[model samples]
Target: MSLGGKVWITWTRKTKSNYVGKIILAAALTALCILMLKQSPSFNSRSPFSNHEPGVTHVLVTGGAGYIGSHAALRLLKDSHRVTVVDNLSRGNMGAVKVLQELFPEPGRLQFIYADLGNAKAVNKIFAENAFDAVMHFAAVAYVGESTLDPLKYYHNITSNTLVVLEAMAAHGVKTLIYSSTCATYGEPEKMPITEETPQLPINPYGKAKKMAEDIILDFHKNSNMAIMILRLFHPHVSFFHYFSLSVKTQMARLGEAPRPELREHGRISGACFDAARGIIPGLKVRGVDYKTPDGTCIRDYIDVTDLVDAHVKALEKAMPGKVGIYNVGTGRDQSRSLLRHVRRLTGVNIKVDFLPRRPGDYAEVFSDPSKILLELNWTAQYTDLQKSLGIAWRWQKLHRNGYGTSVTIADS
Candidate 1:
């Protein structure tokens, strides 16, 4: 699943003969996109944090066993917040949850509940059982191509399930919500530097369902004082492992983005690359190669998992009542060819590449201007260098060749 924030598409330039017409058409499209964006009401409330004691806050993390959610849970636990993770384990790996438990080991520091978000009764039951201060909603099926193949699954899982969670939040008086959104919501916007106000013209069912969920939240926000922060993230690359458990007084690979084998086909490209290197798969398949980008391959803004978790923590801290903020999270943009080169170099494998035609629901170039998240959330991606980011993930891959199948060992920081 290509998890990301809001993205912008770089329009290809036409020949000199049609340059004037192209400019006029581009202006019209831009105006239309902005007009469409205005359909949703704006949120001007800021710094809405209420007066509270500086102590542990109970947080309910939906899909906490998944990639980004697991990382966010680790961060929250490290910050001394009581966390309750609810995941059905359909797409989430229990190993990630076990890792969190092993790292914390405290009774109340972490709890895992096997429940699906689609079951409203179970969702309400979970909320009734726990007293949650905030909710990190990260449970969703996020494969762009798969969403195209199974539109109903995307709607039911991403759209309807989000509604169920929001309803439960409203019923339980859980005010603060940190929503994990993707850049795919922007689709092929005819604009550069996508902002919160950019038109959300999603092209695929995954993006459409997510956009619908955002709309529902906005509608609810209009009537109530629910503090909401929707983070539209760009492509999150590489598995982030390596953390120091202060309680243990040592550093270890306690938590990381370890997707299960079944989901790898629909998971991050980095996982597939590592699998190919480890001889688990044949070779890397370059999906699209005729894109309009410099390398004729799609370009995306890849955010490191560590940096992605940091953005969520900052948003959770800044969430306040009656205020809503939407920000784009990304580091910078890199083409597919460049990423493959890095994987090959870092893994020291001559990864075979099979150039294929364009993939469905895929855009040519997708990146974002993360200035809003930087200014509002005070968050900026630290792992900006692709080589450095991939290098870190590759090291983790080397250690966990079977991905949580082997016993984790303690290592010096």
Candidate 2:
């Protein structure tokens, strides 16, 4: 063969090899870009569960086994959303989750995990495993007196743990968050019917910790495409009917039958009063009867638990990405004696009231001007009739003397 022929053949082979390498590199780069786009919250069009049909949002209910958290979970389940409840059971009750399981017997509709938000690894694992569309954060150490005594626990559980949840959400592209905040963030308001514009001058560690969590959530929203809803709930009472129904349903559930239809309204104080009437507790200790109010007792705005839970559902559905919504959840009425009198009427017992000195950090008057939630979310307190609300509570307490069919004493207030 000729030398020119050999050189031409070798050059052709080298050029073809280089061309193949370039094509492979280009393909790799394109695949990398597509993967990045799929993971990015701004670019991603569908949830992690792309196979699922549209409009079926999967929600993570943190502290789902607690009082308010359980109620939120139940509502979410009823709304046909897949709910995953995470709780450490530190303050939450598994019995509540059991009741919820009885209430929502449908498989795959509700899930419960014995986990804590403070554990970043556990939180991240849950987020990684599930495609959550939003998060309703209700887990926190919220006892006012306990918070004052153990401020560190409050700070860790409320503030630090919230940061962990936010971090996980940001990393995993979960953009919507409905935080269970409190009117305690307002402290002792200067006037009546505290508006959303009311200054947040928290007087206790519990409120301070929650306010800190809110600040962090806002900061996260500022940096990400996060949609945040802060529902500052006033005193949300559970109705006797709620406890009665739950107790009855729980018993019926054991017999392989469906739970009863849910009734609106739930009570908080009526539980304690019923306990007193039934002689479970000696009597009700009226806290702070000299707070400079009309009845000399500290006044509070109490909304039914069902109403409060419904507000969360509305907030979850209406929350917009990159926008923040803050609303007060309450009935917009202040009552002290009226609440006690109604309790007496419901229980049909002369409830003995022991007037005690005001507890520390107790607010003088704190109700809500919930007009914003009403107008914006179209949410209203349906059970505004206090007597009817208490009556429902009385019946429940009378039936479930042990509370939720468990030996564990549920928090009455």
Candidate 3:
């Protein structure tokens, strides 16, 4: 078989395993993701659509139905703003949206469409329907490891599709945009903390694709007076207990931490699955700035889900002037050396953390210098103090320890 054919076959097999195997993996992933969500403690729904602001009479949110997109959409609705959601429903789930129907504050104010941005006709139709004040483009394939193996998929989705969307937006005279960016764009950093001025050198196709899109948008901004805000997201975890009952907080009091906990004995984590609303334990390796920094370990910026979303909402306000705004979206806080100790204290699982050599394309420490965003957007991370933020994560992990999930079956067409 051809190389493409072989990979296609293997991917097909993995996705279409026996019914029972698919069931087990789906249940496991969902439950694990739910717990991960709680542990990370994310943000959603801050801006109401009817804030009655002079900015953005109508907002076009591509990929508005995904995790961050859904949260942004909910916030827009809360501010009483006119909103439209366009998604292909590939990686995005419609069920994730809240407040689309009830308490909308305005009937027919929020709109949703199942369409791909690559289809310029569909996108152009969307632009024609509304005189949008700004566009928040969040629709793109975002998986680190997967991008390594299949860069074409990432490029097509993020690069080609993004070009199509931007052209349509510009042609329709919609100039404002709030883009979702990542810290990985910094590649392996030379400094402990990365500032907005840090050079971007992405190691993965996903980051490269995002960086490519960033360049294209800026190019458009360079020629045109289209205002742009790029929010470079640092990893933010969301940890929450279901229904607010049997809360993760309660579980923490009941259980204590473990010296080392193994997520699965002799098992490994696949790259595509390394997202916030999923598994948490990655073995601690010591190399990066454990000496220069206070801790003998790497520190990363981890903002709350809510705080991250707040940056996006604020970006809309700054979208009209045609000047490009670049800001690091993170807690301005760093995860600590004592984090592993704290995890064990909370999970009561004896996880074995073997110290390995420094992994390539890995940085020692990189948090955000969020001073500009704080000064510019009048925004700062609301959840300060890393320990306090982590407290909620422990609660989510411990609460969902047993398991709870819905069934899903994956297959290749």
Candidate 4:
């Protein structure tokens, strides 16, 4: 063998080894790209439709012009879902709907219909016009005292209207329903931290009507292919725009407080407390200060409106065909007189209080045990700080002092 032949042979072997290394690296890169593409459609917290079937979901939010409903609609819009809001405007504000429209700004992403759920023909017509993937029913007369005074009205609005909605849903074959139930359906629970298993012995007509509606929905679910989620919500505090808008006079009248001429008709305890701190109202009127609690006042689990709506969104995603899911939405913490203290701290004002006797059908304490929802849906309350919640509520109430800018009216459309 010669020196030239040995050198040529060694160079050829080294060149081939380098070529094979480059090919292996190229193949590894290609495999990684393919794997990423395959896993790209997995679940996304920002957008619920990432893992779902293609095309935006159309959700019919009954009472979407109302407080909680409006917030839920806002969340749905944020997650790229098309929302159609149906409201009678009897207890809902059109200004809330207007706000939603302005926020989304995308044409056809949000819509509003002036229709009562009790009117089956109108509800059916709505379903016929649009293909709704789900229905979040929040339309109901929820005033506890008023329901007690006029039990028939509660039955008509809560019970009968629910039946009408269900009938329309069945006709349209809309299988998914997210019902807005209340913790009041459990009445005064014998145990602390009420769970879904608690007996539903509602003490008032309002609670009874909700319970009755729940029964009707469950029956319909059993007989049909409907997926039902009954959320027994606790006290949901104010949202960004302050959704719950009971008349200030009505609330004052219930508490035996003198109505002020300057005050707007719509406000809640959070708003009222904020107003009192700002000297808008005379002072905070504390109703039922003689309840059997540590502070001798009724205790409730106050969850932020945003948190409550988030749970609904999760439930919508998790709803399965021919299944019934019941979850309690609350902070699972008791808040009584400390709520007022928190409000005072948030407002940085010494809020005056006018204590009154306990109202009828008032429970001493009612909170929630939301472990099941936490474990099942991987959902938990984000705005759990009482001061922070009240601060947000106070800011919103201060800006929208008139409550939605105008009273709701029946739309011509």
TM-score: which candidate is best?
A: 1
Candidate 4 or 3, higher TM-score: 4
The predicted structure with the larger TM-score, 2 or 4, is: 2
Candidate 2 lDDT tens digits, 33-68:
999998998685543333244778888999887778
For residues 175-233, write the lDDT of model 1, one tens digit per residue. 89999999999998787767777899999999999999999999989999999999998
| Per-candidate local distance difference test | 0.82, 0.78, 0.66, 0.78
TM-score list, all predictions: 0.83, 0.80, 0.67, 0.78
Kindly report which residue stretches of model 2 are placed more than 4 angstroms away from their true locations once superposed: 1-53, 240-268, 406-413
TM-score (C-alpha) between model 4 and the true structure: 0.78
| Per-residue lDDT of model 4, residues 1-413, tens digit only | 89999999999989999999999999999999888877786422223211233587889899888878887888898788989899998777777787777767776688889998888888889887777889999998777766777899889999999999999889978889999999999999889899999999899999999999999998877788899998999987654423323444221111111113333223356667776887877898877867778778788888888888889999999999998999999888876557888888777899888987766666889999999999998888888877866765665455445555533232222
- Structural RMSD, model 1: 26.2
Candidate 3 minimal-lDDT segment of 10 residues? 266-275
Q: What is the lDDT of residue 177 in candidate 2?
A: 93
Error of 2 at 202 (Å): 0.4
